[model samples]
Target chain A: MRAVIMHGPGDVRVEDVDKPTLVEATDAIIRVTSTCVCGSDLWPYRGAQKSRGPARMGHEYVGVVEQVGDAVREVAVGDLVVGSFVASDNTCEICQAGFQSRCKHQVMMGSVGTQAEFARIPLADGTLVKVPGEPTPAQMRSLLAASDVLGTGWFAAVAAEAGPGKTVAVVGDGAVGLLAILAAQRLGADRIIAMSRHADRQALARRFGATDIVEERGAEGVARVKELTDGYGAHSTVEAVGTQESMMQAIRSTRPGGHVGFVGVSHGVELDGRDLFNATVSLLGGPAPVRRFLPELIDLIMADEIDPGAVFDLELPLEEAAEGYRAMDERRATKVLLSV
Target chain B: MRAVIMHGPGDVRVEDVDKPTLVEATDAIIRVTSTCVCGSDLWPYRGAQKSRGPARMGHEYVGVVEQVGDAVREVAVGDLVVGSFVASDNTCEICQAGFQSRCKHQVMMGSVGTQAEFARIPLADGTLVKVPGEPTPAQMRSLLAASDVLGTGWFAAVAAEAGPGKTVAVVGDGAVGLLAILAAQRLGADRIIAMSRHADRQALARRFGATDIVEERGAEGVARVKELTDGYGAHSTVEAVGTQESMMQAIRSTRPGGHVGFVGVSHGVELDGRDLFNATVSLLGGPAPVRRFLPELIDLIMADEIDPGAVFDLELPLEEAAEGYRAMDERRATKVLLSV
Candidate 1:
């Protein structure tokens, strides 16, 4: 089976590897139909994050169950499914509280790497949500997105409390941030501001329901948001980039008592306690509980109500995984869908 | 008129000063009936915070309206009232959103020196809440507490989302933390854990409805909380100490989907974004919009349903203001009420 692996920083490759087998009764082996390169993947690929030697490379996937362990009751052979980046027993207190990513018994699916021909999904019943019907190629891409980005963006919007009467400012222009604008729109936000300097991404942001765009970054970006919000700052802001500047921008761009939902994986970000205290904003973020929104997202995609798959600007065969990584790392593609 | 003045760090004096006069049409002159020394005052007194020369020393007070500017309509001369530590216009969008402390037109009452014979309150119609009737000495003290500590505690509990079926953990043993236990109780939290090592404070915590007490600090305290909550941590945690350790402890002690409401005046605290992200808990904190909770708190205190005044373990006349500061600075009193 061909699988993506990283030999070192900026060195992603697709090579033949042994197909995965179920190691637990609760596991299911899935033949991946679609997968993608995430903005987060750029962390290690760009050497911003340390690599633990050669490692398995992807976490997002829409696939068909090829084999099921005896304990896998929710999903079976031939069933289409989408799973969260993090595997969780949905019954745990944390998961039940809608924070499945932090479930007591959790496994990060990134370690299992879905950019492959076949992958073993642990806690199959709890981690994978079965798709209701056959999906077209476009719907398959959207379902693949439901595995991570779309659900993450939805969580960001919900966390930011972006709803009717809200002016939501998104601080990143990546796929997740663009999708968060869509989520905020669906959640009934009155206005959506996409903070993007990139023209192409800004266009997509507008297409996805952004009512405004501010190309500025940092303090200037916050100032722009405030100017647009009657100098009170936006009612809600989403920080989809984990850098210190983006985090602070999100916090500062929100009005007092407003919400800041940050979904980007943090890297070297240290927030001054005084700043956070003085900002007086409600903050909820981290690895999103994608599983919590997966069912609804799947329904939305299948029903054609949302087209999150539009984020995939490039597509490549599994053997061309390196080019996919390069395209994303160089900002040539917002997201790359890999035909596994 | 006499006022408590911080000449410098560790030097507080009761000095003759000119009585305050209304400078704004929105101002109201209040004859200080009662004021209290706050734990935050100890910060400047102990030199943890820099002193900007001689400074006014208090922000919490219950008083009678001595005079009112033309625009002061909500409060009138001779009416007893309580004003939040931060004076707010309350009509601004921020205040209307229930974040009065961060209102567009806010005045920190600490600058007005509430521990004086008479003080001027800005935004009187929005900042001062008149008492329904004459208050007994007991009720007067509680009303004074509502000016800051009680209201701050209530805000913390509310921000932490304490309510029925929730387990609340309080991270500081100061008046605000102890009062937060009372607020959590009033909010109907099922279990309340007071993290305090001081026996006297612990007794007060129990009286205020603490169901359990954890003496451990830092990681051990978090561990104890998790042990008590079946390894999931508290559903709501109040951080009333603005130290790095207390903030982290509060964050760490809450379950993934739980909330941490902090109200302590932050000094030297820096939060690692990674730690907060991985914790996956909601965070809301700041100076506290005390005015938002004042009206209900007054009703509760006036009805004798709560005894927040019990936190004032010592009392002093205006002449002994120096001793009040000393007692609080020396940790000899939990709180000291001053009669003007």
Candidate 2:
């Protein structure tokens, strides 16, 4: 089986690796149909996150179950399924509270690596959202997105409390942020503000129902958001970029008593205590519990109610996985999809 | 009129000062009946926060309205009132949203000298909650508590979402934290943990319905809290101390998807971005919008449903206001009340 592996910074290769098999009573072996690169993936690919030895890469995938262990329930062989980046037993107290990312039995699928021909999903009963059937090619991208980005964007919107009468501002121009605009719009936010300097991402943001676009960064971005919001800042902000500057922008962009749902993988960011304390904004974020929203997102995708898949601007064959990483790393692609 | 003023670090004096007169259309002059020294005031007294020239002190007070400006409404002359440290128009969107402390027309009463014999209250109608009538000496303490400490603790509980079936942890054993235990209990929390080292404070915390007390500080404090909570931490944590250690303890003490309501006047507390992000706790706090909870808190105090003022162990004549500051500053008192 061909799988993606990282040797070092800026180096990605697709090499023949042993296929995953059922190893637990609750596990199910699945043949990967589609997987995509995430903004988080760029961390190690860019050496921002150190890679020790060659590591398995990717966590987002939509696949067909090839085999199921004796204890597997709700899913079986031949079922088309979408699972969250973090596998969780949805029945746990924490999972029941809608924070599956922090579930007691959560396992980062990235460790086992989903960017491969076959992978075993643990806690199959609670981890996988079985689709009605094999999705058509037109819906493949959206289903694959439901595995992570779309669900993550949905979670961000929910955490930010973006809804009727809310003025939501998104800080990052990545795939997740773009989808966050779509999610906020879907959530009935009265005003959607997208802060993006790129022409392409800005256009996508607009198409996703952004009411305004601020082509600025850092303090200037916060100023523009405040200016647009009658000097009070937005009612909700989705921080999809985790740098210090982007985090501050998100915090400063929200009005006092507002909400900031930050899902970006935080790196080297330290929020000044005085700033956060004085801001009086509710800050909620982490690895998004995307599994909680997969059912709803899958329904939306299946019904053609939302096209979150449009974020995939580039596509490649599974064997050419290197190109997918390169496209995203170089910022040449908003998101890259690979068919296995 | 005599007022407490800060001459310098470790220096407080009660001296003759000009009595305040109504200067704004929305102002009302209140004859201070009761005022107290806050933990925040000690920051300047202890030299943690610098003092420039001699500055007016005190922000918490319960008093009789002595005079009213032309535009004063809701509160009039002779009305028994309790007001928060910050005065607000209460009509602003921010105030309507229950964050009166951040209202557009907010005026920190500290600047107007609430410690004085006669203090001018701006936006009197919005800032002062009318007590049912003149309170008895016993009720006086509770009413004065409602002015700041009680309201702050209540806000912290509300912000932390301390409610039915929730486990709550308090990170400071000052009046506010002890009162927070009471608030959490009233809010229906099943378990309330008070983190304190002082036997007196811990006893008061238990009296206020703390189900458990951890006489530990820093990392040990968090470990004890985690241990009590079955290694998952509490569902809600109130941070009533502003130091970085307390802030982090409050955050770490809360389970993922839990809430941390911090009401301590943040001083030199820097939240490490990575730690907060990875912890996935919802953080909400500020100079509590105490005005928002005053009406309900006043009702609770009036009905004898709770007694938060018991935290005030020392009382002083307004002429000996310097002793009030000294008692609190030297840690000889959990809280000090001055009868003006």
Candidate 3:
């Protein structure tokens, strides 16, 4: 088996590794069909997050189940499937409440590394949702997205309460933010505002149903959003960038009593309580419970209703995994897919 | 007319001032029958908040309408009314959405100085809710409570989504928080937890429908709440003391997907975005839209179904306003009422 591992910062290498095997009664061994370098992967690659010895590199994947443990019921041998970044026992009280990320029995796929030839997924019955059949190449790409980004974006939109009559704003132009625009559109938001300076990302945002784009940042950006919203600000905002300024912009761009659903992984940012208190906006965000939305996202992708995989601007062979990481880390690509 | 003015920190004086008259087309002059010192007043008294020279102090009151502007339709002269701390034109889009405090034509009663013998209330028709008729002394006390603390606390409970089968936790033992327990009970909350260390406050909390009392602060308080809630924390948390620690405690005491409604006036506190992002709790709070709940709260008070005024532990004459402030500042009274 081959897997990508980072021994230290700026050091990603794909090398031979021991193959995965079913380790728990709820575990399933899957042969990777495709995987991708996520934006979050840049946290350690850019030396922002501390890395220990030989840390596994990926958590997004589309695969075929090769073996299943005794307790695995939803997936079987040779079944095509999409699994979330976090493995969760759907039977837990938290998962039952639609918060799979906080499931009583949960496992981060990062530890097992989905960017490999073979990986064992814990809580397989809860984590893996099977595709109708072997997917076409484009379908496969969209299915791979369902493993994390699509589900995450959908969760962000849902958390933001973006629906009919809502004017929604996305703070990040990354894959998740772009997909959030699509999700908001699908959820019937009347207006979608995308904050992006990149020409290419802006085009994609427009394609994903963004009704407007604000090229500005901070207070100016918030003002622009207010201008578009009759000076009331957006009714809902999706914060896909977890920086201090971005969070504040998202909060400020939302009208009083509006909702701000933030799904960005906060990178050591602190929010002033006074600002939040005075804004009178509802703040709801965290590690998105992707597993909770995985099934629906897979159904949408399989039904050809949404094309979220357009976020994959670059593609490569699994053996060239380092280049994929470099491309995403350097902002040369929104996402890079690796064909295994 | 006499009014309580804060000359400086730790300095309050009751002095004769010019009686107010209708100044705006939407304003109404009211002869204040009663005014009360709030927990927030202590902020300036203790020098936590800066005060300008001879600034008027109170924002909560019950009064009789002395005069009404040409445009004042809902309220007229000689009407006995209880108005919110912030006067809001309830016809605005924001007000229609139940966020009257953020209405375009909102005016703070604090600036108008309800502590005076006569106060001018702006947006009178939208802010003042008249009682069915003149009432008894006990009913007057409850009606006064409806002016601010009761309405604000009820809004907190509503924002936190307290209802049947839910467990609610209230942070802060002030009038608003104590009233929140009663509001939650009325809203059908199965259990109410009041975080209070004072024996008198705790006893009052229990009397007001608090099912449990946790005499702890910060992390320990959250832990105790979790222990009582089967490790999932409360379904809803109302934060009535605005501070970094209290806000965090309220957030921590709520389970993932739970609601936290905060109404405490923030005093230079910063909330860590990372912690909030990871917590997966919904945060909603601000200067409460008391006007939005005025009609219902007035009904509750009029029916003699609830007595939120029990939180007022000290009563003084209008001339002894300084003692009212002193009692609240020294923590000798949860709340102080000044009869004119």
* Candidate that would win on TM-score: 1
Clashing residue pairs, backbone N/CA/C < 3 A, model 2: none
| TM value for model 3 | 0.98
Residues B157-195, candidate 3, lDDT per residue (tens digit)?
988989999999999999999999999999999999999
**Between the candidate structures 1 and 2, which one is better when assessed by TM-score?**
1
- The positional error of residue A65 in candidate 3, measured at the CA in angstroms, is 1.3
Full candidate order by DockQ, most accurate first: 1, 2, 3
True contacts kept of 3: 0.79
| Residue A49, candidate 1: C-alpha displacement in angstroms | 0.6
lDDT tens digits by residue: candidate 1, B83-192:
99999999999999999999999999998888899999999999999999778888888999999999999999999999999999999999999999999999999999
lDDT of 3 at A6: 85
Model 2's alpha-carbon lDDT is: 0.91
Model 3: colliding residue pairs: none
Give the distance in Å from residue B120's predicted Cα in candidate 1 to where it truly belongs. 0.3
Descending-lDDT candidate ranking: 1, 2, 3
Q: Quick one: best lDDT, which candidate?
A: 1
The parts of candidate 3 lying over 4 Å away from their true place are none
